[model samples]
Target: MTPYTPPTQDQLLAISVNAGIEELTQSEKFAHAESDLVEAIVEGVGQFAAGEFAPLNRIGDLEGAKLENGVVRLPDGFKEAYDAYVEQGWNAIASPEEFGGQGLPFTLSCNVLENLGAANMAFNLLPMLSVGAIEALEHHGSKDQQTKYLPDLVSGKWSGTMNLTEPAAGSDVGALRSTAVPIEEGEHAGKYKIAGQKIYITWGEHELAENIIHLVLARLPDAPKGSRGISLFLVPKYHVNDDGSLGNRNDLRCVSLEHKLGINASPTCVMSYGDNDECIGELVGQENRGLLAMFTMMNNARINVGNQGAHIAERATQQALYYAMDRVQSARAGAPDKTPVAIIEHPDVRRMILRMKALTEGVRALLYYCAGQVDRGTIGDGDAKNRAEILVPLVKAWGTDTGVEVTGIGIQIHGGMGFVEETGAAQHWRDSRIAPIYEGTNGIQAADLVTRKLGIEGGEAMIALFDEIARDAAEQPTLLALAKDCAHIVRWMRDEASLDDRLAGSVPFCTMAAVAVAGWQLLKQDKAVSAGAAPALAESKPVSVRFFLDHIVPEAHGLKASAIAGADLLYTLPSDKLVAG
Candidate 1:
């Protein structure tokens, strides 16, 4: 399992700029990321990924993590690789500088995580969850809590987990039944004891680090029912002293690990809290406001899940392309009869490869653009913040769903080799299946797009996005042709007579909106390239953008029609009518 050596600077410069490293380097927005810092981080991740991480991916899956005597042990090499990650300062990419973080731009964090995911997704779960925990603490933890926990978490000296789902509550947190009772008279009077079970917790219990901090959501006594009653707590595997050193072990224990379809190397645990009546957790933020506090982390985790999709898709696409180039088959129409040609020479194969490339690059562009917006919101003043906030969900929903589709195509390109586990194409396909399911399902994402994101500011945000696309199309003739297609769709969507049509096509309409928005960003890159920014990059921006607009964007019409058609066809049939009974 040799790690793919990343393209050199000059070689990278020659690749397509729709979402290449060269363009990322040249973008004006990334100017804040110091050149030395970027180079060091990228090189470190590249080497670690190729040398240590990638080799262990399959091995980890085969061996898997194990639970013994209430202690969860990670697969071999995981501890060493994790230590290397911490030593390289990879975990601090997006944390605050004052709290032991490097305070780098979110875009850089996205880039680093992409490589880590590509190299080994299962092992990367530890840091991913740690960062999510760090974000939750940064946004809601008290100054004392931040001072005590931020350093260790950011430094990767400890790991973290978000315990949300339960046996009864999966997508709906409102149904959660975990409870927290305050201690009366003790050394930890302000702390509460958490008691309940949480399911589907990733990195829930592992011996990868010194400690594990669980961000548990539970109900307090005398509180209201449902979501309003829930509160967040910082429950640790090993209690921490006032000075932040590890203390006595807590009562939290991993009851069992889930048998998952993919990401088998990353242990998903069933954890029980206060099983021994000694689990003390400090409350985060106000009681009954835990849901609000958890949203910050959920949103962050959702975006990362989307990136998981994007990163895996990129890896799969690369694998497919490599196989297509090397696996020779029957000669094509123009070739000599007895000779064999690479699969890449066939028209259908080329179409599939091109489709994979276009979709992967398109999603990459969307995610990177969204990453830039996040950076701006964090560092740029005023309006930049507003813009970045608007783009978050779109990036999350579109990026991840596209990842699933692209990875599936990656398998298609590999043919029968993909179905066999040995080729690893099936692994990508299996691993990527969870992206859309977790971090909020794709259907939920679509609902949010329609109900919350699209209607923000009374639909002004969406209108503005449409206007920006129109303006871009107007300025560039090549884009104008594609924009014209988008404009037609938009016009139809807005027409009073087309309301039913639009509603019927809501899903497709949303899909079109995604492509239109993605194309808008791609066009900006085209403008940048035309202006001599990253001049050495290949000029596939127009071709790729056009391909999406021409072939993919039209799905909007059908989707919009279906969305507007109402749920009649779906819901009208009674249960009895639907079945033989």
Candidate 2:
């Protein structure tokens, strides 16, 4: 199993100072205490993650989650670990202080999530989902809904889940068949009786918390077709009393959990709401405005999922690096000793390690940068907000796709043992596989990048982002030409190509943008390090940036060409005939 290393104090400090996080927190009266508080929080989270959560990663994977008698029992130690997590107040690190949370900057929370996710992703999913639920309620929930739900949710006395996917409606949310009927009278007036099945619900039915709050997306009886007519509901597993005590059971149950290839410990549940037509839910926002509200949570989840990619990649990189150092293989080139040397000495293995290092560090920087941008957005910075929106899909898609790639490489580093499940390299690869598929598939993300985000504010966001990257690259002699190459591809996609052409190469284009953004961030770090700040961590900045420029950046031009190639060849071969033997 891989050892989880918390972000170096130097790295975290650099990110905070560069991202204006200090300024943001200073505005909140944490100016004097910012350095000390950030350090304490980071150290506290790292210790909790390594001591409590890391040990259980393997056990959770082995035992997975068990469902019996309509209840979900987490793998042994999971509940205890979750209790430790709650006790440490890790759940409320970035939540608003008014709601019993610490109200720390999102960037700091992201660092905590990275450490925890690397330690044990399956266990971490519980709190990750809860954060999204808190965002939805904090932004869009009714006053009563917030008062009744926010406290326990914020306090970690309760857990939460987002119910969006159905068997028939995974990515195409508009096709969901879940329905809700309005309640006419009594204490529950304006509420709805929700009835439908929701599939792939993460932490949907766990026994670790006093209550489980489900944020469900359902259509009203007289609602129109598709997503526009949909509404959001806050449905608790156990109904609550006027005084906040738990009451009768709601009409919902986890029918089953999926046996997955990776992250088996995080239950992917098949939930049936209102089998007896007794499931009641309060609207989260105005009727017919549910998608708007759900997006508040979904967008947060996208970045978080991107961080998952970074986390898994970081874990995989650590394992691979360790394996390379310990794994003895063929002799090094020109070495007099015939005895085998560590695989780390092998040129190709070193290359692979560097690739993993570059990707992990690059994505980590990008994710943290996005987190900082989010904090800026929260404080009402319009440009920062738009940039954050533009970067979400990139971070989610590229970050995750990179995780899958890096983990596979980690497996490769193990040689024979990597193929065996016992070594744990394979587990990382398996766990990372789902990231690109969920939280909006990478393909959907690409399409969004091409069609939705590229056109935001009449393309001002895209323009500003390109300029931002290019400007930074211009200052760094090593990255100037590469940045120009990236700008050329982006411009080609925007000015010359049709939507179909854009989608054809969306994946590559997205990758190009992510690498460029990451490269820019790394150079920024390099500059900081050049000033003798975090000198040790800074030394690697140039190497990672060089590797990214030489290896990863070259793919952009080709991807742009492929994107402009159009869809003619793709459709020319009939799908049925093409697949025939």
Candidate 3:
């Protein structure tokens, strides 16, 4: 049996209640994606993901992506699955209509990727990055660039890679030493010769797509130092003729692949550009503005990365629940009929399952809310965009952390069998461990939340959201208290905190804010039960929300002391001394 089962009902309810799907469809931009159409899309993608991607999950992890003859090869069946993914138009659902997309709501696309990630996290990376590329180009690329690239990229006939990290530059985009020199003369006079070594290039090399697009960041000769000097370039694996036909191979190739903790089925390549001094690339935008353009892509990726939390957590929770219900173990603690019983009846096991359910559901609701904000923001709701920007770090950081926790809980429910790979239980945990570390680590997210986002519109928007949540959670005073506390801390952070203090307390404050925000969404779902907002899930939704408010949201209160703790204590123990202990 496959480890994943798409939570179709839960997803739809989250979209309905959390994403405000009805309100979203009222916007003229997304008017075509009516309730019936949205339902059909979600169901179709769910079935497709289950049939095409789920069975391949274990196979992909077992066989993994391979590098042979300097070419990266994905697991068998990947090409066929990818073909189905493209042929079905799943890749272009939310892309712009001008570029061959259906022009649906962002939430619809989010649902599609969520299903794919749940089915096979590794397999979805290919299309996820491609969508990110489409976003970047749609915003910043020149008309020629968009015309030449958007259709294929949106169609999933071509793939994309963001080449940012090098050995010397992981998160510090400015520290990169890659160079791009102007050609000055030729058929491609405006283009430049790029030379660089990029590591951690996801899907950098693969045969599934007709072409691979590399968005490379490099420094122009004699440009200003640091990040201001860097520029973004569109470097393709194969040159495209003016007629849009594939031409000769470019001077880039995958030199090596990394052996990673998980997602082994998705190739992480060490890409070398201009090895033969012939790699040519067109500038993506104005010179030295690469970081700004790339941020467009990064911001989108961050949200999806956060949603991966919900994706993996849902699959893991389902697997754990199934195993607990069927795996016969010790007798119930108090029941008189005390022969061996299913572990589902055990208190401890019950606790784990409930916690997993609560965390996943809360995180899912929050991300879905964020998705709705995107649609609202796109349709001229500037306030909604501001709200989304503030919540993104929370989703990216806290959501991913929840993925790791819930997946680990899933493994715990499986017990000894969980530790063994044969049960496919541990793989969820293993695959989930990377979420918090990538797409701008959870630590970076915290720092951004406290230092940058806390100051948005002088923190008024954030405080207002807190005020709303607090009002809604009046009966659940625990959540109300946490919401009020988070709003107060936002004021302190914006007005009085030192940079060091903000950095030191960032993580805890991040956790505190995320929990409060999540409580806000969970409570919304809970209130919707009898209101007919999410009728399909009325029974289970209330239970999950109650569990979250009572058990999980309390963590916010516990983190307050740490959240406000100043920087002094963190520096008291020197780095070496701290490590020595």
lDDT of each: 0.74, 0.84, 0.90
TM-score each candidate. 0.90, 0.96, 0.99
Q: Where in model 2 is the C-alpha error above 4 Å?
A: 10-14, 29-33, 475-478
lDDT of 2 at 477: 47
Winner on TM-score between 2 and 3 is: 3
Residue 53, candidate 2: alpha-carbon lDDT: 90
In candidate 1, which residue ranges exceed 4 Å CA deviation?
A: 7-32, 336-338, 380-382, 475-506, 539-543, 556-558
In candidate 1, what are the lDDT values of residues 1-581, reduced to their tens digit? 22555422311222223333333445454444655666676667767777777888888767777878877787778889888888888888878888998776666677677778877877777788888899999999999999999999999999889999999999999899999999988798989989999999999988879999999999999889888888999999998999788999999888999888788889899999998888899999999999999988887787788778767777787789899998999889776676889999999998888777777666667776666656655644445455555556666677777877887887888889888778888887777888878767766666666556555665565666666777767854544444445445444444432334444555554565667667766666656666776554446655665676556655543454454555456657878798875
Query: Per-residue lDDT for 298-417 in model 2, tens only?
Result: 999999999999889988998999889998888989989888999999999999999998888888878888888888888788998988898899899999999999999999989999
- The model with the greatest lDDT is 3
How far is each candidate from the true structure, as Cα RMSD in Å? 3.7, 1.7, 1.1
Each candidate structure's count of clashing pairs: 17, 0, 0
Give the alpha carbon lDDT tens digit for every residue of 1-581 in model 3: 34566788888888988899999878799889888998899899999999999989998888999999988888779999999999999999999999999999989999999999999998998898998899999999999999999999999999998989999999988999999999989788989999999999999999999999999999999989999999999999999999999999999999998898888899999999999999999999999999999999998999999989999998999899999999998788887888999999999999899999999999999999999998899999999999999889999999999999999998888888898899887888888988898779999999998767877888898899899889988999889999999988888877888999888889988888889989888888777776876567777888888888889888777888887788999889878898754
Instruction: Report the alpha-carbon TM-score of model 1 versus the true structure.
Output: 0.90
Order the candidate numbers by lDDT, best to worst: 3, 2, 1
lDDT of 1 at 158: 93
Ranked candidates, highest TM-score first: 3, 2, 1
Q: Candidate 3, TM-score vs. the true structure?
A: 0.99
